[model samples]
Target: MNGSEFARPIVGLTTYLQQAQTSVWDVHASFLPGVYIKGVTLAGGIATLLPPQPVDAEIAARVLDRLDGLIITGGKDVDPATYGHDPHPTTDEPARDRDAWEFALLAGALRRHLPVLGICRGAQLLNVALGGTLHQHLPDILGHTRHQQGNAVFSTSTVHTVEGSKLAGLIGETSDAQCYHHQAIDRLGDGLVVCARDTDGVIEAVEMPGHDFVLAVQWHPEETLDDLRLFAGLVEAARNHTTERVNLWPPPN
Candidate 1:
C-alpha cells in the first residue's frame, strides 16, 4: 500500500499535570493545549494524550507498544537537580513527577526506536535525558529577554539550521521560529548533535544520529499551526514505522 493508504499513525503526546478549574471543579488534571492536538491531526496522525503517571521502564514499554510516535510537549521547567545543578532564582518550581514520567517514557521510546519530537521544555528534557546540562536562564546569559519576551508572550527568532541536518531538510536552513523558552541546552548531550541555532548562538534544535526520527526544538512549533512541516515530517516517519512493523510481523487476517 502507498503512504496515503496506510492506517493513521498513533502519536502519543505528553501532557501537563496541574491544577485546573473548569465548570466549578478545581482539581489536579492532565491537560494539553488544543493546538497540539490539532497539529497532530492536521499532520495525518491520531493523537493520544499521555499524562504524567507513575511509569517505569516496563510501564513505559507497554505504553510505547501502542504508539507509533511520541511527542514530548512543552510545559514547566525541568528540575535542575536532574542535571546536577541547583535551582536558579528565576527558574520556575520543578515538576518532579512530570519530569520522572517523561524521562521513563523517553527511555522506552529510544529503546524501541520510536519517532519522537520535543518542543520547548521537551527539548530541554530530551537533552537532560541524555546526560546534558541546561543554562537555567537565558536572560542571564544573553543580557536580554528576547528568548522569552514576557508573561504569556512568545517572541520571534531567526533560527538557522545546520546544513544537511534533518531539521534543516524539514524546515530549511533559516526560519522565523516562535520561541518562549528561558532555559536552553548548556552542554552537549551524548549521541545528540546540534541541528539548529538562533542568531545569538543558542541551540535551537538537536537530534540523535542514526535514529529514524529523534528531533527536538527549543521553539514552540505548535504555536504556528500554519506551518505543519515539522508535524507532517513526524507523522510520515511514524507511518513508515507502522509499515515496517506490519511487514516484519503481519497481522492476522
Candidate 2:
C-alpha cells in the first residue's frame, strides 16, 4: 500500500506523576521519534499520540484495537515488588497508578500482536510484565560507571556494539543515545532476547523474535531525531499489520 494509503497510527506514550501534587503529572512526551510519522505521513502514513495515565482498561483496549502500534516511553524506576522483590534501598518507589495502567495496556497489546516499541522504563515495564526482574540500582550492583550521568535532563552517551540486530541494522554500530536511568535489566523476561548491551554487559536492547514487533531499548531514542529509524521501523511494521488485517477481511458487500 502507498504511504497515503496507510492510516495514521496512534502511538501510546506512558507518563509519570510529579510528587508535589497528586493531580499534577508530567508526560515525558517526545516528538523525535513521533516526527518519523510525519515522514511516514508525508510518504502517506498517519500518526497520533496516546498518553499513558489515568489508564482505563476498556479505553486502553479500544485504543489498541484501533492503533496499528504502541510506543512505551521512558520514566522513573519500576517498583521491585512487581517482579517479586523487597524494595531496594536505592530503588525509587513504584508508580502504582502507572504500573497498573501500563501492565494492562502491555498485556492487551501483546495479546492482539500489535507492534510495540519500549524505551527506558518502558523497557523495564515490558520485562516486569513478562515475569522478569531489574537490577534496581546499577551503580550499587553492576560496578559500572554511572549510567545515569549527572544531568537532571536527558544526557547523551555512546552506545557501543553494532553487530547483527534489528537495532544495529537500523541505526548502525556506535550510535549516540541519551541515558537517564539508574536501573538495568537484571533477569530477562520470557521470549525476550538481548540484542544490545553496553561494554559493562548491561542489557540495552531486547527483542521477541517470535512476536510480530516487540522491541525494547534502555536508552531514550525519542531524545534524538536523526536516528529515528527505530520509530520508522515500528510505523512501517504497524502499516504492514494494518494492511494484512484489511486484506484478511474484505469490505462488507
Candidate 3:
C-alpha cells in the first residue's frame, strides 16, 4: 500500500517532565505546550508525545523504529558541562533527563534516517548533541535585549535566510520570525549549516544538508500558527519515509 493509503505519518515529539499542578492533580508529569501538538496536527501529521524514555534497553532506537519523524522541542537551558563549558551566571539549571533523552532520540532518528525538527531550545540541543557549543547568554555578546523580549513571551525579529538554502526555498530569503531565547548557536556542529540569522547576526536557523530533513530554528514557529510550510515539509517527508519503510520491510524473506 502507498503512504497516502496509510494513516497520518506518526510524528514523535520529545516532551519535558514538569512539576505540574492543576485543579485535578498536582504531580510531576510529562507535558508539552499544546501549541506544539496542535502545530503538527494542523500540518496533517499524527502527533505522539514521547516522554523521557524509561530504563528499557534500546528505548530510543525502538521508538524510532515506529516513528516517521522526530521533533525535539524547546525547553530549559542545556547544561554547559555537556559541551565542556563553565556555566554562566544567567544560565538556568540543566534539564538533565530531557537533555539526555532528546540526545538519544536525535541519534536514533539520525540512524533511522528520519526527518527531524528542532525548535528554540531544541535548536540549541541539536547543536550540543552534535559536538557544538552555545553562547549561553546573548546579552553579553550583543550587549542588547533584542533576542529575548520578555519572559513567557516572544519577540519578533527579521531574519535573513540564506539565498538558495532549504529554508529559503520554503519560506523565502527574509521573513518575520518569532523568537525567544538568550542562548544561540556559538560554534556550529558537524554537518550543520546556518540557513538563517537575525539582524544581529545571531544564527536563527540551521539545516543538516545531505540528510532527509534536519532543520532546527531558534524561533517559535508555533507562535506564528499560520506558517505551516516547515511543518508541512516534515509531514510530507514523513509520509514519503513511511512509504519507503513499508516497502523495505520483510526484505525478501
Q: Best lDDT goes to which candidate?
A: 1
The best candidate by TM-score is 1
Ranking by lDDT: 1, 3, 2
Backbone clashes for every candidate come to: 0, 4, 0
Estimate the TM-score for candidate 3.
0.96
Q: Please provide, for model 2 over 129-159, each residue's C-alpha lDDT reduced to its tens digit, 9 standing for 90 to 100.
A: 9989998888887665468865566656677
**Residue 114 displacement in candidate 3 (angstroms):** 0.6
lDDT of 1: 0.93
Clashes of 3: 0
- lDDT by residue for model 3 over 1-253, one digit each (tens)? 4645465999999898979998999999999999999999999999999987553339877888889999998889999999999999989888788888888888878777899999998899999888999999999989998888776777899999998788898899799998889999999999999999999999999999998888999999988778898888888889888888878776885
By TM-score rank, best first, the candidates go 1, 3, 2
The TM-scores, one per candidate, come to 0.96, 0.82, 0.96
User: How large is the C-alpha RMSD of every model relative to the true structure?
Assistant: 2.0, 4.3, 1.5
Q: How many angstroms is residue 175 displaced in model 2 relative to the true structure, after the best TM-score fit?
A: 2.1
Model 1, range 1-253, lDDT digits (tens) per residue? 5553478999999999999999999999999999999999999999999999987888888999999999999999999999999999988899999999999999999988999999999899999999999999988999999998878899999999998999999999899999998899999889999999999999999998899999999998899999999999999999988888877775667
Position 125, candidate 3: lDDT: 90
* Candidate 3 or 2, higher TM-score: 3
